[model samples]
Target: MKKLFHIGEYFQEKYSQPLQRIGIDLALGCPHRSNGGFGDGCIFCTEDGARARHLTRVGLNLVEQVACGIEYVKKRYGENVGLIAYFQSFTSTNAPVSRLRELYSLVLSQADFKVVIVSTRPDALPDEVLDYLEELNEKYELFVELGIQSACDRTLQEINRGHDFAAVKNACARLKKRNLKVAGHFILGLPGEDFNDWMYTADQAAALQLDAVKIHQLMVLKNTVLAQRCNQNSNYVKPLNEYDYAAALKSFLQRLPENTLLMRLMGDAPESELISPRWWMKKGQFLSFFKEYFYSDNTQNGNFVLTHTADGTPTLYHPRYRQHFHSLAGAGSEAEKKFAEPSALPERLQKSASEKRPLRLLDIGFGLGGNSFAALAHSEKVSGCALEITALEFDLRTLQAALNLYNPNSKEFNILQELINNGFCRCGNSEIKLLLDDARNTIRKLPEKSFDLLWLDAFSSDVNPELWSQHFFAECFRVMRNDGALLTYSSAPTVRGGLFKAGFTVGETPSFGRKRSGSIAFINMPQEGFVPLSEKEKHIIFDSTAGVPYSDCSLNAAPEKILSQHKKLVERLRRRGVPKWYREKTVKN
Candidate 1:
């Protein structure tokens, strides 16, 4: 509800009529003006004009390029969408203001064209150019995309960005003053940059109030300055592991302001142009790895509070905890008992021949498939009840790992397979199906009122905020039947608030093992004679500043505002008997 507006979203909305995108090759060189040196621009710069060779075949002039681009977009995206004339050549605004206006006007004069997007350097923008952009914006939707590779001056210089860090700040401020939307482009894994640098970049972007941000993992482009550097020294650039990149991205997202539109989490460089990090060739695998990390990790945007310097730069501090973990691997031992307790289902709901229908169970965050196995075991206990389990996993490899760990030939695997094959397995007396994908997106695809029971076993809320927000919880609520119940290992106040907001009648239940005293349970409907939040219960919300119950239907619900209003409720609850762990997580100032 925070008005998420990514570049793609903007394009899709602006061209609600008909959208067309035409790539124009200005053939204009860099502003630096080198004598027959190709400008040797940034290390990662490409001279392919950001257009495929086929477009070049027609002609290199502005009019010819626009004509070719119009045909390409029409063929590729259908004829209905209006056209976006993209000036993708090297530093589109590097030419004189008069030339820039003439070229932009050529594309604008076309009847199908609806918008113009200019990609340029911050240093290139003069007052006269700003005026031209203002004029352009008045006529059509204009987007000014700036390439600010990193917030750290050291990193910027190391990459040979050819500009000072101050230029980025100046450009952003100027764009805002002109009432123009700005998109900041950044690259992770640049030379000499580590995970901390990526985090710092996100913090800087948040502070700068960027409307949208685009992040790309660095790859050495063949024949480019970066490749030459890497070739000169083997250790000049080290490719990040899939896991490391995912973790870095998660951390970056956690620090990013919630309102910032994330234009892209990743980008694809032409295979012909790529050099190192061979693994990056598989874009699908890279994306899958990130998805898996999100489901298994519990951290949200703004979860880490920034202890700042006087100059408003963020400094490092401890991260906020928003969820707890229960160990299921050592369930039979005393150690395991410390984290989780044995299942305590009512006798009526226990395994019985009369309840012959397959037990429909939903397992969220199917990381490692540990909880899915547990659910299978539970179904087995319910005699004659088939365990129809829907296990949602975000990462394909993790799902593969889970399948390998729990082989079909094994006894446990056989039980789960039987449920899938015959609707029920007598050994475990349960049935299950594995749904692999991001639960937030995948859950919406499920038919409404389909699930009977849901196992909310995702990572702690502190690590994965997108999945824990009121918007996602509402989707969970809709998919569940009126009588369905949700069980999770989280005792965090925010999770409780989200559940309540989704219209669940939430209450504390005794937790298993040494993990904690209780877990949260949410019933779809309140008990027939149950009283709404009592004074003591209301106090918990106030004390935690956890906010009012966020139903999925609520629009534009700002997390900060919600938290502020419930501060007293959180405090009052803390005064009562709240767990030490719960009380330790204070509201981020």
Candidate 2:
């Protein structure tokens, strides 16, 4: 047998450790469907109904799943073992940027996770996601594995893969441009192909200049089109028996370039899910056999750098935004104090049941869902009325990311998981609604004056000025009940100005986060727990250019347009004489 270069040895030499990759099903699921207009997924794929896996959280939550894998590794490899967070199964890059960040962050937050392996499809590598990945690669060694399946165009089409070889080539090029370690996935012994075809696939793969390559014996699984064909005519779908498969894989391996890192040699599914040659080989047993057959085993790249705060909860440093998603004080604490408490949402929600009215809620910019989750945690205290929540978010992918944090064992997560998948979560009388689009556009779709509470938890005004624009506030004011209260962590002069100008009676709540006090607004003045704005604050809101608030004229305009309009207004103000109440800083600017 010709000896093949082992990936395990190469990774061990580089990382100076016996590294292992812990595969966690991201549940992003493949976008290509058999019935969808675009195209069906591969004929051998058994990932039916997995794209929205966030909705149907099968088995353990991602974190728990990782923990389980970690324990198993510890038992085998002993303690102090670091592992790569391998995002396996489905197309990992299928969600929004927000979601991708959250998903990546989950692994990065845990100290044991040192490297990340992003497994995605060749056709799904959009420029936006690539850009984000490039930014992440600066902080962490990131490896991107593209599922090429087979290099031949005919084989690709026969498998119902939406894209062709050209697309895969372009995607590999883009990843290489970002200087990311690229891995190409291929399958040996695909139907209607002989050893010569495998050689062709190997040649095509080598030409791509990939850092690594992964190939597994093709197995027809249950419910797959191939499985049905195999049932009808076993000869038509001639899967290599164990002995034949080992020989074919060896042939393909010898043909592959020497420099390529062999990521995977074989793939397997659960016995129940598989309808194959019935070779019940454990992954370890197969790997051991492979080492004796040729050689191998291994683990690099991370995305977010996690920093622990006073409360011990870690915060994720966002690479693109160059900011922390949570407060420096602590993520969990900030969620409870800054967002949930000040809003008095728990109390209001409890009151809704007795009043026989659904507690309508509007959560703006549901980034990590900290605020909403905080409210739900609090709601466990008492029975609340049916919750009619309308959470507006630009990136719906975070739902998948957040859903992966807790296992199905958590009753709350189960409810929330259902909500994330289906755009609504139901538990008894409580109902949570999700609007997965830009808040500006989606806000209009909400019913008028229907919400009793609104949590304005978007990014900072400087980073996200459009959310604090007068137009957004006006729309928010329109959707809120007369007695409704809007709470936000922002106490910026611009934010207060926008709220005040939008016909809200703005007040200061308890101080938290990066501000002296959080903001609370009401259409009707609250009788208690509200403080009127001081003269100093009023001066900043009404007189200073700093308070010259943003305006999204059409409510659907981009942030750049809104900022451009604000700059023009400030210039017009500058053209006029400096007003008496204007700050010296405003006049100089």
Candidate 3:
């Protein structure tokens, strides 16, 4: 499964030990420098960004510096440490391929350097340079890092980045075609940009699918053009405080592709260099809080943890039930694929919503409201379509946790905040009502035959079986309109059996993504149009031991008690040799 990976963790696992990076200043300078491409670098960037300010004092060449950095690593970390030759100084690819080859070959010749990184502006990586880098990869691990700070052209101009977002896209695509490992470096808090702009940049970064990412709050360093700008406009640089940056990182992490290594969360800003946003805590101290923060608030929120699934969407993991709110494939995509699309909900609701009366939707076991929000994304824009959503949630804390974890700039953040601030959220004609009580009891109180679309998003049958019982399904059947369709992500026999018993004409939810088939039931679905469940699944629902469904008649029975009741029914059925498919009919014997 894909996960949020730290650079240190990824390297340690790959190399059998942590690999330290040796910062090597090639002194190659940048294409965007005064003598080359654009105006004097980015407004905020100094030579410190390319090569350390003190690097010229050492007066060491690339190979000599790699040797010295290796010795420094040996003293600092341990002996015989694996080192990555990080060509951090300026644009490593500014030179011709011949000179670039010579410098990179010298660095790779060192026995301890297992990998060499080339950090350069996207505009500097021409096709010829990429071809050369591709060839170099066969001999040594090479990562071509790009500084694509902003996706917006306006933002790029403001920063004096000297290249448009298209150049970054073209360069990354060129490198990707050569199967090169690439990382994009992003700096937040650029001048005249809001949180929305930052979100746009992060989304664009994720779309690149870079091998890794380096995200940091922009540091206002001394003796830079940004300083003068900041001085002129007091609001030019609004630094991120602890919560601000932490929240910002969470938002970026949420959008990041699965398995992309986080190269750095904060910059290596020396105390003597940084101008502001200091004094509260050092970077290390903030990281300690950042590491602990992911775990701390979840304690009050029912053991709910945030984890990314295979497709890079953030999902909620319930440690108590050991269940994930989304599929291992993905969270958002899974909901849209397995739940929303399978039901043809978008089309149906759009039509229903445009009618004189609004469509009514029932969301069972609304954990963090992913399904509701996804459905809303499609239905909210329908002309004249009004919606009434009645959602049943046993634990409100999960929603609270989502608010704490998600970036406030995210749509989910706004949606969740709206739900928390008000008991419900209304978009156009759609209205949602959240129920805090147990669904088994609360669902029964909803108006009968009121819902046009039902999202049966209850917990897994065996894991949290109370909501999957015959009684609960009957209540769902009672509440759904004659034209209503109920969609569920599970095709489990137990769940199917309950739906069948509740008088729903069971059908198969169409295959999507990695999942083949989900379950859906229509109040009066014709067999001609929709996909039907196969004979094997139907037979299992009718005859298999797993077909013994849970039944909580009182609507308040504990899960253990409900299972015991179902066990007795299964025993009785087995003794009677019912469900003829499971019974023996021996004549000659």
All candidates: CA RMSD in angstroms? 20.8, 22.6, 22.1
List candidate 2 segments past 4 Å from native: 1-309, 314-320, 579-589
Model 2: how far is 398 from its true place, Å? 1.8
Model 1 segments beyond 4 Å from truth?
1-5, 14-20, 49-54, 280-410, 413-589
Q: Put down candidate 3 lDDT per residue, 456-549, tens digits, no spaces.
A: 8877777788888878889899998888888887777778899899888888877655455788888885423578887777777887666777
What TM-score quantifies how close candidate 3 is to the native fold?
0.51
The global C-alpha lDDT for each of the candidates, from Candidate 1 onward, is 0.62, 0.73, 0.78
Worst 10 residues of 2 by lDDT: 296-305
Task: By TM-score, rank the candidates, best first.
Answer: 1, 3, 2
Runs in model 3 deviating more than 4 A are: 36-39, 53-55, 295-589
Per-residue lDDT of model 1, residues 142-163, tens digit only: 7787889899999888877789
Best by lDDT: 3
Task: State the lDDT at 432 in candidate 3.
Answer: 78
Candidate 1 has a TM-score of 0.51
The per-residue C-alpha lDDT of model 3 at residue 71 equals 75
